[model samples]
Target chain A: MPYINIQITREGASREQKAQLIRGATDLVVQVLGKNPATTFVVIEEVDTDHWGIAGETVTVLRERARQGGAQ
Target chain B: MPYINIQITREGASREQKAQLIRGATDLVVQVLGKNPATTFVVIEEVDTDHWGIAGETVTVLRERARQGGAQ
Candidate 1:
């Protein structure tokens, strides 16, 4: 099983929105990967803007220049 | 780079313990995977006893049967 890890920046998500994102993302993995939801473990991480970085840039730093809010 | 994903329940962890778990787990990935911390993205998810499951069982469900706790 190719363990897929994801940390989606929950910047503008409402409580419901966050929940949907987590559930949907996990479900997507289950559907695409054809893995059991039980074995297909999913972790929903609510990352801080400052803590999470990519390509040597923090999510917050990227967000300032981002035209659109969400990307992956 | 194999994207290693983990869902560990913070059942018996203290505040400091939790931070260490996140830091240490991430660091271990960095060390073992030989991935740049910048590119070596790590997501430390504090799972609930109910939500996080493994092998068709919740972390809590397994913990009851655990010998000394902390395995992987």
Candidate 2:
């Protein structure tokens, strides 16, 4: 069984979008790795911006900085 | 950089537990794979029972069956 985990910031993604992600990920693995869809597992994880870090800074801080920079 | 994602059913885990998971996973990667903890990412994903499946049945259904079997 092949397990694929997709991590994204907790932006407001709809259930339909999540479903599409699950389907697309499964399809890709099946196509590229010849994995069986029945046994393949695709999980979508929505992480809070505060908990997700990048380059030693959390996404919350990074996004705020970007917004301020854009307004300047 | 090493990325580790841990998936568990949405069973009301506390923030402390999640933190422990993150720390433990990062330490494991550093000790075993010799990855830098600073660049190591650990994400904990809590999934709904309905969305997780095994043997063609969702975890929701499986847990219910287990409870019923225990009562009988």
Candidate No. with top DockQ: 1
Q: What is candidate 2's CA lDDT for residue A21?
A: 96
lDDT of 1 by residue, B2-68 (tens): 3445456667667787667667766887888776656554455566654444543445556776756
The lDDT per prediction is 0.60, 0.78
**Model 1 chain A poorest 10 in a row by lDDT:** A1-10
TM-score of each: 0.42, 0.55
lDDT of 2 by residue, B1-72 (tens): 987767899878876666666767777878998888778776666789999999999999989998887642
Runs in model 1 deviating more than 4 A are A10-12, A53-57, A61-72, B1-7, B12-45, B48-72
Give me the displacement of residue B42 in model 1, in angstroms. 14
Residue B48 lDDT, candidate 2, scale 0-100: 99
Task: Considering the true interface contacts (CA pairs under 8 Å between chains A and B), give the fraction that model 2 also has.
Answer: 0.04
Q: True interface contacts reproduced by each model, as a fraction?
A: 0.20, 0.04
